[model samples]
Target: MRFRKFTSSFDTEDRLSITIDDIARPLSSIQSSFEGGKVPSEFVAPLTKFAERYGGGSFSSLFAEGKSARQKQKLVEEFGSVLYSMETEEVKNEETFLIWRDACRDIIDWGLKVDFMLDHLKQAARDFFGYMLRPSGSESSCREIIQMEEAISQLRKKLLHLEQKLGEAREDLHLRLGDDISSDSMSCILGSSWVPQSRASRGLY
Candidate 1:
């Protein structure tokens, strides 16, 4: 999400940082990037599809209602007035006001950009959640939902396998405790961290 602007611009030759990689990672090894430096042509199509359907508008205004740069400029005008007023009370603070106003303006721009990018990423995640529910029916069709389904199917198989392992946990009439995926008390329930109980000594068996 920090790298949402990567959606705004890229070429077949462009390299990516880890943040962009996380968002636009290849679906399978067939679409994977090369070691250290591979152009991101494979990801651009889906990202473009996402931007068109869900971005609301231009890359500059992706998740935001308006252009963040223009909004930042408006904020500068409003806050610069306050900085100027503060300067009037001090000893020839013209340079100081200029410095503080510029710094604050930069900070505001950064905050707005970061906020919009992160929001855009969160919205994309929500969209994909719906897409996973009904892959072919979703508007985001550029992405290969089959790949996602395969990954999820693999996970389901693993969970079923784990349930088989847990079936072996039935011993000495001890009721095996299972947990929801959230695993609220899982840490205390596992391994050396577990405190042994005295059920055998109590003659309950």
Candidate 2:
């Protein structure tokens, strides 16, 4: 099938309809790393290793550089090809798939990175509270701990609200993808690879 653009329109309660482009941009520039010999062409491995040994020990740091960004894009491209080759059985139930689903929140959080973002504030508050409350007899600091606990509670409420909003957005996107097709479309998409439960009784498996 020929590729084509897909777009959607939705009236969010916030009165904004956001359109995300399908085409991905290069992660960063890749020239300085090549010039400085700081990156290797081992483009198919997980980038965490490359960053640890060469690109300053942090994926975020590598992402901050233009040259490292290009390399990252290349790495992602290669990784995506590997993903396409995987059997559905291997990916559909994997921990990696679940992490990407969970990490969608972090991805969206980074996109907004706004001042007064409650989810971000909540993460900071929880981190601070954990670090501060670890001392012996820290329970004596009840007044301060109470305030932090209140802030964290409020943050949890806000995060739940935002999660509901994101869920609605995803539902809208799913609806817009197209009316749900019949099992024929599903069979065509899955090819003759696996027998459906309904057909397996007929020795199709």
Candidate 3:
């Protein structure tokens, strides 16, 4: 199918709608099935390593960057400024309005990154899950791969819930924030090949 542009009119991304279909294809659909335990050349190592090392010391916290000094400082400052404005007076002007709007966008940015990472992890697990299904693999290893797949399943559910909360919260930020925010999140959309179009794609997995 040809790609469509992202231009959602709803506060919540109506992911099934024509507007959101391209940018908000559910993460579960990001990787098409790998028939007969096959995967693309680029994915073999990452998919394999991810399936094995998950839930172990080798894996990193998903929130490390989100909670890092720089990100914390930035979010704190933005929150404080927006809160200060709200406490002092209503945000009526474009400046104060945009400040609040941007603060919300920043929050969305974090959510998007986390969602993207989780999607990547789950997709990696899926690819590896398929890889493990090769006839020569041990039964115990097959069980282990299934376990990882089940664990990763939670990520997609959480992201769906997150998108709902984010959409709801955007109401207070103003209904148009989705439109006002750059098509930046547009870049987060993925196709069946597993390429993430966003800058958030870098180092995601």
TM-score of each: 0.19, 0.21, 0.21
For model 2, residues 75-103, the per-residue Cα lDDT tens digits are 34433222222211233222222232223
| lDDT of candidate 3 over 134-178, digit per residue (tens) | 578476887998899888898888989999998787565454555
- Compute the lDDT for candidate 3: 0.40
lDDT of 3 at 187: 46
What does the lDDT read for residue 167 in candidate 1? 64
Ranking by TM-score: 3, 2, 1
Model 2 regions more than 4 Å off = 1-140, 179-205
Error of 2 at 26 (Å): 83
Taking the candidates one at a time, how many backbone clashes does each contain? 0, 5, 0
Q: How do the residues 106-148 of candidate 1 rate in per-residue lDDT, one tens digit apiece?
A: 4345442323333443454445444445547565554567678
Q: Is candidate 1 or candidate 3 better by lDDT?
A: 3
User: Which residue pairs clash within candidate 2?
Assistant: 28-69, 28-70, 29-66, 29-67, 30-67
* Model 3 CA lDDT for position 172: 55
